[model samples]
Target: MLSALRLGQIDRYLLGQLLAGLVASTGGLVALIWLTQSLRFIDLVVNRGLSLAVFLQLTGLLIPSFVAVILPITTYVVVQFTYQRLASDRELTVMRAAGLSAYALSRPAMMLALISVVTCFVLDVWVVPSASAAFREEQFRIRNRMAAFMLQDGVFTQVSDDMTVYVRRRDSDGTLHGVMIDDARQKNAHATILARRGRFLPSTDAPRVLLLDGTRQEIDHQTGRLNILTFAQNVIELSSNKSTAQRFRDATEMSLGELLHPDPAVVTARDRPKFVVEAHRRLTAPLTAASFAMVALVAVLRGAFQRHGGLLRPFIAVLVVVGLLAVGLMIANLAARVPALIPLIWVHAIAPGMVCAWMLFVPELRLGRLSSLIPGAAA
Candidate 1:
């Protein structure tokens, strides 16, 4: 039992090393994507004369979303790398000779996989959904206030070609009194309008504008004729702006509870397959950590080599893992088109489990003694 404990410790230590490397690499990749996406929004703010505060706040909110997306693949990668490295070294050979087998080494992986799956489940079902929604809503708020904030660079900003919007100044008072509108659209047509004060309200899908109360001077471009008129209140449309758009599907952003109990309307006829795929993928993400743990062991922890090709075994193991992932993705895509193929997710999740099981049962892969129970027990 003491010897068994020692073997388990060694296995765990090796696994930890692999897990660290995998998560780091995956996390780095995710961070890079996040930065790229953030830069896009940052550019938008810069062109619009918006401040840096909103920019940082918006990008910071996107981090958790990236974490959910990258965790699963990274978990698998680390395990595969860890196990193969042990196998390539005669360390595995020594352990096996001391009566440890593939199953023994994989025990650590199976246990860790369960932990990883749970983490993923919590991230997908809870953290990510809430963050995404909050981020989206905040964006809506920012766009709504975009015009108001435009008063930052100067007391006023000319948001439109013919309109000059001005604020006497900003203080706790929230007062905006703007004057001047130049209408020069048609040939030789021009108008200068003034207002006592104005209020800005954002339209859902058009130019952010303000309502003005004052007088107007109109000139007919055709004849250069001038006419003066007065008005109580007139709405002037500002420059058109677009809301932030992204490619992420609803499934990618929903919380676990939401996935399980999506609004019936949300699960509409056109997008059912996508939701199904996403829901199942979330539940199964954790399972793969365990499965990969085993497979990584099989690929890397098997075979007692005399020369110990340190990196070769790991590289080969990673290749196997990558191939399996590719197959899994292909199958998942096919399944999406045909839900009957939904079994593919299970297949991908379980393939590694089966491979690890095989390694546990086979003895030739490792130079090790058979346990006392083997049918052809060595005397």
Candidate 2:
């Protein structure tokens, strides 16, 4: 009973260390990735005049997706590091001498991997889909509707692909001074408008600007004659006639059911393979956490201890993991194109852990030395 209690205490200590290392490494990597990824949207804040809070809110929706992708990798890294440290400190040696088997020593890491698997499932199935939808919707709104309102004082702002607006000065009362617009929405009738003063109209569907004392100038396409018309007040729509209905949902923004049974109207036959691949990817991705943790355990705990601490096994394990990650990426890409190979994804996610677990545990069982495989059995 005393030995069992002591073993439990050691397991708790190991689990605590693994959990701490996982949190720190995961957080640091996530923050670094977020910084790099958020750079793609820095123009929204700098050029579009979006506030810092709004920028943070928009980019923050991406954290769940990032966590889901990196959790398995981080789990493997933490387990590998923690076990190697214990071994280098001769703590694993002490545990082995105390009659702790390989399974007993690896129990804490298995628990950690299980936790990661559960978290990854929750993120991939629920949190990521909703957050991705919201991010895309918000990005669309900012580009289409709110972009006109974000015009800077002196910089030319591309409100939409077909429209460019420039304002010389903007007042706190929402009045603009000296505005110019280059409208190319019409195929052959490109027009340039110059306004002495203007203000954006309150709108939700499409942005519009009301110009005062403005002149609309256009060159006739056929005759090449410049025609200028002066008006006291005119309303120019800032964005093209694009409605929210025109926005198509991406696979990342779809739930599992939606991916599996997509609307034929929205998803064409050519795109069906992509949807199927995404659904299967989400289902199988979480299983990789267990597989990766098992690989790390096989690296640190599988072989006999060297008096001088060998680096060959750990280095080989790292190479194997990198190779597996590359292969997984290739398989996902191939499956996306040729979905007949979808079973490869499931095999990729599950096979490594199964093989590693057998190598680590089943061989010991086959030796007919159950006493050596169980903690305190030799006693």
Candidate 3:
């Protein structure tokens, strides 16, 4: 009973240290990246007059995706840093001298890694896709609807790739004065319009602007002739950035089931491979937390401990982890090209964890023989 209680206490202490490191590393990275990424949408808040609440909601929707990317890396860092700290402080030495085996020493970190893996899995399977869908929906609404209402007086605002609108004045009653529009959506024709007064009209499919006392000057490309028309009132439809009139959710926004069993009618031919790739990526991504955590544990816990610190060991671990990440990315890209490579992605994710676990648990496995396989292992 005493031994079991002591083991429980040790596990709690180790888990707490790892959790602290995980929270700090993950929060700092997420905050830094969020600051840089939020700058991309600053124009929406500053120039487009979006409300603070709306801005916060829009940016907050991206947190799940960010967490998905940061979780695995942070788990690895937490394990590496916590174990290294314990070793450097002679805590690991004291524990080892107390007759704790390698597996006993690593049990808490392994359990923590398993927890991280499950968290990552939840984010990958559900939270990220739902959040991504919401983000895209909100973004489309802001770009297409809110931006139209943000039209400033005497400022040229681009509504779409082929449309630009300039308003000299906006009345309290929502009427526009001295409105000018440029429409070049057509390949063979370009039209420049000027109106004395105009008002925006709401439509479900396309947005329209009503202009009174307007003149439209159109230039025909084939004949190269300028045709001018004066009208008492005219309605102009603005082209949208989307190719199809209906908005289609991207693969990244689809649930795991939808990605795995995509509707052929809804999915285009070009997007089929992307869906397959995304499905495999989701399956493999969460397992990376386990793999990365194992790599950190094996790197630090193996071999003799230096009195000061094992700087070279951690450095080599970083290099190995970086190489693994590079290989994972490269494999993902290759899997997208040739479906045969898809299985390799799973291999890359699982093999490292298995290998590291063996090295950590098996007393027979020596770091010396593995030195030849890994360049800096001997060092």
Candidate 4:
């Protein structure tokens, strides 16, 4: 009962520490992301001809995606820092004297970890996917508007392969006079055609191009034959860089529920290992929050606080947690790619530090204590 009570109190303290740590950490991270993304926006606006409105809007929408990538790392860092502060202040020692085992103190960290897991799952499953879909949808919309840039007057417009067309003038009625076509690759090597006037027709489903009017002339260079072709109007295709469509997506966009319930046509044929691994990743990411919390707890119990530079050990603990999390993530990703060891992906994410949490629960592993479970700890 005493041990349970002691654990409960430490858990409360840890909770207090966690709340403060989360606000300071996530706030700073979000601000850093905004500043960096804004610089990228300026570059796109000045150099890539992106509109300020679109750039800013895209920047705002991109925050969720960034958060999805950085949230685990952020949680891990904060947890480590918070625990290290307690250790530095000798609060950990006080809690231990009150019959609290490291394991008991770890309850709060584990609770926080559990929360992290649920939060990460929601992000990967819902928030990130929706934001990504919106980002892609708006990108297509932006490209369509940008395609108008190709409508330059008095230039040879090559909209696609096998179509080269030139227009001398564009009338207000959307008519082009003195149309010249060098469509040699389209059919029988038609070298050039001169028209009195021409009109543009954009495909409703496809890209837009030009249609010639008046008279058309054709020549076969192989036979040195000049063929006079006359028509009321002729069709020519021009290429435009505007896309108003979305490409087919692979499995990365899917959530755990969707992946498990995938269509036979989508999931059957040739199985994709990346997607299978990603599904497992989604399942395991939530566990990472708890695992990160444990690591932080251990670091906190072992850390010391300096009277003058109080936050340094805590700060270093945060960095260490972040670094270890990054390494674990990288290992999991690489394991997912290897077909022979794909099943190891889950292990990579969750197994690395299982023993770290044990130190908190068992007193023997802690400093100046041995066999606390034995009748009289000293032999």
| The 10-residue segment with the lowest total lDDT in model 2 | 237-246
What is the TM-score of each predicted model, taking all chains together?
Answer: 0.69, 0.92, 0.90, 0.66
Q: Write the per-residue lDDT of candidate 1 for residues 1-379, one digit (tens) a residue.
A: 5665566577668667756776687779888988898877875487666668868778878887677666666766766655556656666677767765566656656656666778777877778777778787776656545655566424456544444556554455544555555544433445677777665664563344444568878876667778878888787655332332332336766765566566676667556676777777777666776776666666565665546455665666678767876887787677678988887798788777776677666564454445522422332
Distance (Å) between predicted and true CA of 131, model 2? Answer: 0.9
Number of the top TM-score candidate:
2
lDDT of 1: 0.65
Q: Model 4, residue 255: what's the lDDT?
A: 70
In angstroms, give how far residue 264 of model 4 lies from its true place.
6.9
At residue 25, candidate 3 shows an lDDT of 91
Q: Distance from true position, residue 245, model 2, in Å?
A: 6.0
Clashes of 4: 7
lDDT of 2: 0.90
User: How would you encode candidate 2's per-residue C-alpha lDDT over 76-144 as one tens digit per residue?
Assistant: 999999999999999999898877888888999999999999999999999999999999888877766
lDDT of 4 by residue, 1-379 (tens): 4444544565677887786777678778887988886785575477546878888787777777666666667677777766666665777667676655555566666666777677778887788767767776665555444322344478886634555667788888877777776665546655577778766565443434455455566666677777887676666544332232345555666776666566666666345556666677767766666666666666666433344435554566567666766776776667556756665656755764576656555545555454443323322
What ranges in model 2 sit over 4 Å off?
Answer: 145-149, 222-230, 240-245, 371-379
Model 3 steric clash pairs: none
